[model samples]
Target: MGEIAGGIATAGVAVWLIALSACDIRSRRLPNTLTLPGAAVILVVAAGTGHGLAAVAGAAALFGVYLTVHLIAPAALGAGDVKLALGLGALTGVYGADVWVLAALGASLTTGVLALCRRLRGVRSTVPHGPSMCLAAGLVVGLSATV
Candidate 1:
């Protein structure tokens, strides 16, 4: 039963990430509707699975970091990215701090590379970070599962 529930939760996270990534790529926006509820659902599931502390810590850490970035340079990191971090952090946090750190690094590096590519192409518009975030988290989750 627990395994079944965990699988369902994982699926939910995957779907949520994919949906948000698509939306962000298309409109450069992450809806509060998806971000808020997705975080809540993951947190609740984490608590139920005895990983509440890690999940909360991860969510808070990411939220704080992103929020500070958004505050310092609103043009650099948008509010949507900050909000999206809550759920991604919780998802990786449930696995462990190591996984969370890996996901964070992956997201940061992927975004940086993407931005550099865009700059090289002379497209001066903003690069959507949400897809990078989602991809990193999803990849980390998949890799952690295999390990």
Candidate 2:
């Protein structure tokens, strides 16, 4: 029963991520409607699964890190990316710290690749970041299942 519930919650998170990523790609912004409620749902589900406090802490920490980066280099990161990271952190913490680390690594690698591609094409680099987030989320979820 617990496993089944976890599976359902994970599926919901994936769907939510897909939708949020698409919206962010189109608008260059992640609406609060998507991020806030998604984070709330993850928190509630994590609490029910006995991982609430850790998940919340992880989310807060990730948010703080992103916020600091945004403040230091406003042109480098967007507000939507920070909010999305918070949600991803909550999901990862609920699953495990390993998943969180994997997600972060994945996002970083993807961003680097995109920047390189932009440079190769002689285009000004401005990644949407949503696709990378979705990629990271998917990788983390898949790795969590296997591990």
Candidate 3:
């Protein structure tokens, strides 16, 4: 499981997720300032620790998938969300495919519930999905530890 089993990677991801969530919620933007550098750090650490190829491939694959979705419906997700997915993919990859699927499911459920609640409140505007991503990241990381 790489250093995520050691907890350092998970801790780093936790902090990064919090920052990303806060930025997205406050400004409805996930700045390149955060996601780019964060992705770099994750890649470097993963490579140095011998999970390089898997991490890079996972990030690329997830980024591509999300990018495709963004291309199809640009209004549904911004570039920032795609970038955030890259980082999350790498983090999840270190754990495994099961963890990745679980995290994605968690994110989807969180987002759906949040969206439903906002709709019930008569909010028709976009709901920032960054926090839901963070929630999923935390879930995957914590759950992976136990499993």
Candidate 4:
């Protein structure tokens, strides 16, 4: 029963990430319509699972970090990515600090790789990092659900 529930949760997160990825890739935007509600849902789930404090802490940590970067380099990181991180952080935080760290690392690495790839192709524009963030958090949650 636990495995079944885990699988369903993983699938749901994956779907949400995929939808966000598509939007970001298309318009370089992570709409509030998705990011805000997604964060609320994950936070509620964390609360129900007895990880409310951890989730809030994770969200704040991630949000603060991203917000700092956005403030320092608005062209390098978008407000949408920071907003997206709130939910992603909570989603990973429900598992533990380790998972949250891994998600953050994964997202950073993914974004770096994408930027490198674009630079190599002579496309100097900034890469929208929302997809990488979504991918990282989804992978973290899905992997945790399996274990």
Q: Is candidate 2 or 3 superior in TM-score?
A: 2
lDDT of 4 by residue, 63-129 (tens): 9999999999998899999999899888888778999999999999999998999999999888889
The worst-scoring run of ten residues by lDDT in candidate 3 lies at: 1-10
Q: Candidate 1, residues 1-147: lDDT per residue as tens digits? A: 378876886788889999999999999999999999999998998898788999999999999989999999999998999999999899899889999999999999999999899999998887899999999999998999879
The per-residue C-alpha lDDT of model 1 at residue 34 equals: 92
In terms of TM-score, the best-performing candidate is: 1
Model 3 vs. true fold: TM: 0.89
- All candidates: TM-score: 0.95, 0.90, 0.89, 0.92
Candidate 2 worst ten-residue window by lDDT: 1-10
Q: lDDT by residue for model 2 over 22-116, one digit each (tens)? A: 99778888888888888888888778868898789779877887789889998888888888777888887776777877887788789889988
lDDT of 3 by residue, 3-110 (tens): 546677667778899999999999999999989889888888888879888788778877887899899999888899899988888877767778777877788788
- Order by lDDT, highest first: 1, 4, 3, 2
Each candidate: RMSD to true structure? 1.1, 1.6, 2.3, 1.5
Q: Could you tell me which 10 consecutive residues in candidate 1 have the lowest summed lDDT?
A: 1-10
Ranking by TM-score: 1, 4, 2, 3
Error of 4 at 35 (Å): 0.1
